[model samples]
Target: MFNIYKEMWDRRKMIHALSLQEIKKEYAGTVLGSVWGLVNPLMRIAVYWFVFSIGTRADNPVGGAPYAAWLAIGMVAWFLLNDAFRLSQKAFRSKRSIIKNTPFPIAILPAVQITFSFYTHLILLVVILIAMAFALQTVSVYWLQILYYDFAALMLLLGLGSVTAPLVAISKDFGRFLDTVLIFLFWMTPILWPVENAGPLENVVKLNPFHYIVQGYRDSIFYHSGFWEHPLYTLYFWALVLVLFILGNYLYKRMKPIFLDIM
Candidate 1:
């Protein structure tokens, strides 16, 4: 396992290069190009804000922050997570030409996808910070704690991607199945709804690994709460993420040699 990670680290430059190429190719020929990274998240926040805060009359502010600010915090993270989830599954298929032609490490493919998502996440984070500063009247040091959740999220995505990307390449139906499940996950994960108002379902929703990430974002940006404050959640999240990493690595290794056979 250590050797596997060591190999990936040694290819960091290649990963970075592929990630950038992926981003450029994705937005190639578009007028705004990468600027859409900033625009896409803002558009998503606008629609959700209008629907929930205006249409449904769900105007309760989270942690004293305006509904828009609170929603932005979670939406930025969700957008990143959602992008990683969907793209990672297509990592192998999307890179079919490159995979067949290049001798690069296969593991870096998912890393490239996740890095691309992280780049967009960084832009969205900046937009959200500006919104929070305007709406909340104050920003706290605790906001930096988002790095913890971001790291956790990256690990989870890479782990799951390692497993699913290979499987999706083997059978396209798996991709379709994953797409259906993500729609359910989107609603269940509390991005559009406030956990405080989930009533008896609050505990159940908290069980979702993503809930910790979404809640962590709110805690860092709005609640001013440190991660250490929630000892059990921190422990639980790391444990779950660690298990996923192990499972993902194991499955990825088993599938790696067979991937080209199917592709």
Candidate 2:
């Protein structure tokens, strides 16, 4: 494990280059180029704003925060976490040739996806900051909250990717199934609505760990709350994330050698 991690560390340039290449390739043929990063999330924010504000009333208003601004802050952070988690698992399947032709650090593929997730989230984060200044009528001094949630989200993604990337190599069905499940989870999560306001279905919302995660981001940036505010839940989240990583690493080690053949 130590050796694999060290080799990955030594190939920093290659990982950086691959991540850049993936970013360029991402919006290559599009008219807006890299601006798609800003555009897509902006569109999502607008949709959720219209839905919650107009379609249904979303409560827990970020401690006297504007709904638009609240949604922006919470959703942007949630987008980063979910996108990083969902897409990083695609590393092996997306780069079939890179894996088959070269004996490079397969680990970097997920990291590349994670880097792209960060880049896109940064654009949305900037927009949220600007919106917070204008709509919320206050600047956030919750830099530490943002950092805490970002760190927690990264752990979730890193651990998930480490496990899922290898699973994808061994089982393509895992990817397809994950995509299907994410659709269900998007609704099950409180992105378009608040889990706390689930009425009679509140217990159902409580069962999902993701609802708490979304709440974590929303609380951190939108409501200006700190990680320690909900000590028990926060500890639970990290513990679950750690278990995921441990399982992921074991799976990766077991499956990586046989990945190319299955691919």
Candidate 3:
């Protein structure tokens, strides 16, 4: 695992270049271009706000926080985590040519894709922060906890991507399977609803590592609480992350060599 990370560091320049190119290509030929990265999330938030707040009148204060504020925080975390996994499915397929022709670390493919999505997430994070400030009247120091949560999200992304990218490379059906899995997870997660409102099912939702992240974001902006406030959740999240990291590294080490032949 250390050696794989060392190789990624040794080829850091390649990762940066590829990540930047991917970001540019994502918005290429569009009128808004990179601005869409910011716009898309805002649009989604607006639509959801309208549907739940105005259309259905389901917008209610969650844990004493404004519905919009809670929704934005959850959506910001969800968008980043979702994009990390979704784009990771393409890590090998999208860069098969570079993998076949280049000699750099193939592990960097998922890193590049995740980093590209992180850029978009950063934009949305700023938008969320600004909106929170207006809605809450103040942004507390706890908001900085978002950095910790974002790091957790990155580790989870890299770890899961390490496993899934190789599996998807080997079998296209695996990618579809992952998509279905993510869809189920999305609904199960408390992005659009309150975990407290989940009642008896709250324990089931708590089993999801993503709930830690989503709730952590809300804690940072809306709840004004630090991650350490919930020691049990922190422990559970890190344990899951560590397991995924080990499993992903093992899979990548064994499967990376076969990627070319499969491609």
Best by lDDT: 3
State each model's CA lDDT, in order.
0.83, 0.75, 0.86
Pull out the clashing pairs in model 1.
Answer: none
> Which lDDT tens digits does candidate 1 get at residues 104-148?
577778778988898878888887788788777787899889899
lDDT of 1 at 33: 95
User: Candidate 3 versus the native: TM-score?
Assistant: 0.95
* TM-scores of the models, in the order given: 0.95, 0.88, 0.95
Stretches of candidate 1 off by over 4 Å are none
lDDT tens readout by residue for model 2, 1-263: 43434555687677678767878988999999988988888898889887777877654454565667666766786788678878888888888997889876777778778877887787777776776667656666675567666777777777778878888777889898888877888777776656656899996676666666667766755666777887777778888887886787777777777887788
Best by TM-score: 3
TM-score of 1: 0.95
Best-to-worst lDDT order: 3, 1, 2
lDDT of 1 at 34: 94
Give the winner by TM-score: 1 or 3: 3
Local lDDT at 9 for model 1: 75
- Residue 159's C-alpha lDDT in candidate 2? 76
